[model samples]
Target: MAQRMYIVDDDKSIRVMIKNIIEDNDLGVIIGQANDGEIAYKQISSIYPDIVLIDLLLPSLDGIEIIKKVKNEINHDMIFIMISEVSSDNMITEAYEAGIEFFISKPINVLEVVTVIKRAIESQNLRNVLNQLKNTYSIDSRKNVTAPITNSSRRNTMKIYSELGITGESGCNDLANIIEIIVNERKTNNHFNKYNMKEIYLELNKRFYSENSIKTIKAIEQRIRRTVIVALNNIANIGIEDFSNYKFEKYSSVLFDFSDIRLEMDYIRGKSKQRGKINIKTFIEGTINLLKD
Candidate 1:
């Protein structure tokens, strides 16, 4: 079934542009729209769309407020995508903390809007599947039988790294090692958000080298960074060849920041002189999320 979406931007032009994009791409049906947060909250509560594209600065309640109210009062399952011209990190972070699945900056790019919406839909679908599996297996501990799931997840992770063109890189092993360490840590502590990247790298070095030296940690970090850059180049090249390629679509914004991917694409097309920046933490966290069964 096509995803049910709602538009909640004050600008009618943006709403029209996004609605046109959704219809043209056959992405979904727009079930409702609102020019202000008050009306949006009312319509959204009544209509219960699967996804909401909302402007951050709406009259009366604002986008984040609407999300909180919907989540708290209505108890509906809705994915929110914030549309804004604001570049302030704190505001963006606040929007994320309010439960938005993604954010789109103003002066919308058609390609970006399409890509992000598709990604959001795909992520929601995956969550649904995972939830179904959890419900099926939650009955008994002995009946859990997670070996097949574990193997399948490992294969999928390896395939993603292969598609990113990192399978042959030396740091591929380091990346795999990091995933293993995180999985093990989560099994014990139930989370790994407390540790920083530097600490993770130190732990990785200690696991392999029996000692945590700065030089070893630095070397591991450099290898992983270089490998990640190579993956970025490969993704940029794939995107240049075909923007709608499956691998390009799947890994572009999920594994790295969408802005960085766009910058890399521009550099590959010779439209820009600078290359993209790499965030090891984002890459690792994204991989971990994908690895989850």
Candidate 2:
């Protein structure tokens, strides 16, 4: 069956353009559309679309309110993608917390819209598969199963590093070691963020080096930073070539700030001279999040 979608933007032209893109790309079928939040909520509740592309600001109520209502009141599975011109982080965070899967920034870029919608559909399908699997399997059957070493977190970390184009870097091992250490600590504390970068580096130095020297700690930091920079550049290059690339879509926003990714992408395109800033802590936290997911 074709995936069902609904558009809830106030602008007629925006709705038309998105509809055209959906049909042109054979992405999905638009089941309904609305120019007001109250109407949108009613329509979405009635039709139960597989995905909804909704504007942030609308008549009657706002996008966040509508999403919250539907999620709270209706017992249905749906994906919500917010369309907005707002750049306020607080509003965006609220939208995310309200259960939005993605954001389509306005004035919309066609590639971005198409890519995001495709990703949404992909996510919806994956959820359906997982649901089916859950229904088909028994908890007792799963209890005795053990994942192979090849499927371990360490291997998964290496696979992700390879996808980010950092597997060959000198600090790849150090990065993996750091993640392992964090994972081990998480088994007890669970609040991995409580440990700072300095403490992490100190732990690594104590575990691997003969002497607890500041020089070794600095070297470790520099090496990991350089490796992370290489991963950023690789992601930027992938984005420049194809914004819809799965790796680019998945890691760009999670591993680093989207703004930094954009900066790196622009620099690669010769549209900007400034390079992206690397936040090592953000990268580490993001990686751990990915691993957990």
Candidate 3:
């Protein structure tokens, strides 16, 4: 069966454009459309949809309110895509907290609409598959352990770093440990600054080598830099395969500078490009945020 979708926007033009895009891309079928929040809420409450493309501002009631109401009343798996013209961080954060799967900034470009919907669909499918696997495993497993599944901080760090494709590198474990140290500093020290980064790097050196010298520190730095480069290349390769891949979409600009990521991507995709630079501080800070959040 085709995936079900509903559009909730006051702009008739946007509704038409998004409808046409959905049809053109064969991105499921539009089950309903509403120009007001109350009607949309009523429609969704009567029958749940697989996806909802909703504007932030709507008639009768606001979009965020509709999300809260529908999510509270409707007991079904649904993907909510927020449509908006404004780029306020607070609005975006609120929508995320409200459980929106994606956002489409208004004056909606056709390509952006298609890409965002496609990625959302892919993620929804992946989630369904994982749920199925979980169910099957639950039924297949006979013995139940009394201990809870606890992931150590090290393990969590490794998992996050693996998203960047650096888990297999020689210094990945050390790098993960170093990031944990940075996160700790961020949590504990109000005076933590970039100047303290050298101390953190040296601490990493202490974990690997008995004698810490300029040469060894440089070697360790080089290894880490190379590993970070490898991670960037890996994400770029994933982007080259599918630009809308959630991993690439989420981390490409967050983990590294967007310009650098784009250059690496262009090069990977056979475009003539110059050597790209990585902002180590930016990458570290981004990783720290990713871990903390």
Candidate 4:
């Protein structure tokens, strides 16, 4: 079924333009529209839209206030895209705090709005799939009595890495472990650190207590580089087999930089001899963020 969306803007022309764009692009169907914030809240509560396009400044309650009231009192899982002319940090921050997933600036561009909403919807769908996979694994574990049920998150993480054909590589587990540690550290600090190879290696070295830090870090780096290359090659090979393979379509550029993936793809198709360079920090950080989500 097409996802239902609601538009809440004080301006009728803006609302109609948004509705027309959504319809033209076939992004989703807009189920309702409200000119006032309070009316939007009531209508949203009644319809339970999958997505909401709301103006930051509304007639009665304002966008942030309406979001806060709805999220706190009525619905919690609805996706919100804030439409605003005001770019004040305070207002943006407040909207984000109140659960806006994206922003559509004034003089809305059709492409940007569609792209942002589609990306958000895709993320939500991916999360739902992961949850279903986890639940299925849980059910199967309960039925079978042999091996103990491993951590589902870890299992899922490993499954993703395994799909890229890196499970047997020397540093794969080490990378996974360090990613877990980094994610935990982020949780503790309530913020994500902008990671560097040296800093990450130093942290891992502390945990593992290697005899020679420099040598061990170098070895670790090499191993991870090889493993990431393997993953890139795997995606490229999949792309070669079927250019529109869903796995390749979704992961080709996301797991690595697009330029790097393009290089790997060229190599796979026998167009280039230059090996793709994997950004180790980016790979690990992206994997950590992916698994955490």
Worst 10 residues of 3 by lDDT: 132-141
lDDT agreement with native, every candidate: 0.77, 0.80, 0.72, 0.72
Return the TM-score for each candidate structure.
0.48, 0.48, 0.47, 0.46
* lDDT string, candidate 3, 36-101, tens digits: 999999877644566899999999988999998766544345789999996889988998888788
Summed over model 3, clashes come to 0
lDDT of 1 by residue, 1-293 (tens): 45768999989999999999999999987767889899899877654566899999999889999999876665545689999999999999999998898989889999999999999999767754553343222122345433322345456666779778766554666677677778777889876766788888887776544345665576666557756876777787788899999988877887889888889888767788566788888888888886763
- Candidates arranged by lDDT, highest first: 2, 1, 3, 4
CA deviation > 4 Å runs, candidate 2: 1-151
Error of 1 at 231 (Å): 43
Clashing pairs in 1: none
Residue 234 of model 2 has an lDDT of 80
TM-score, model 1 to reference? 0.48
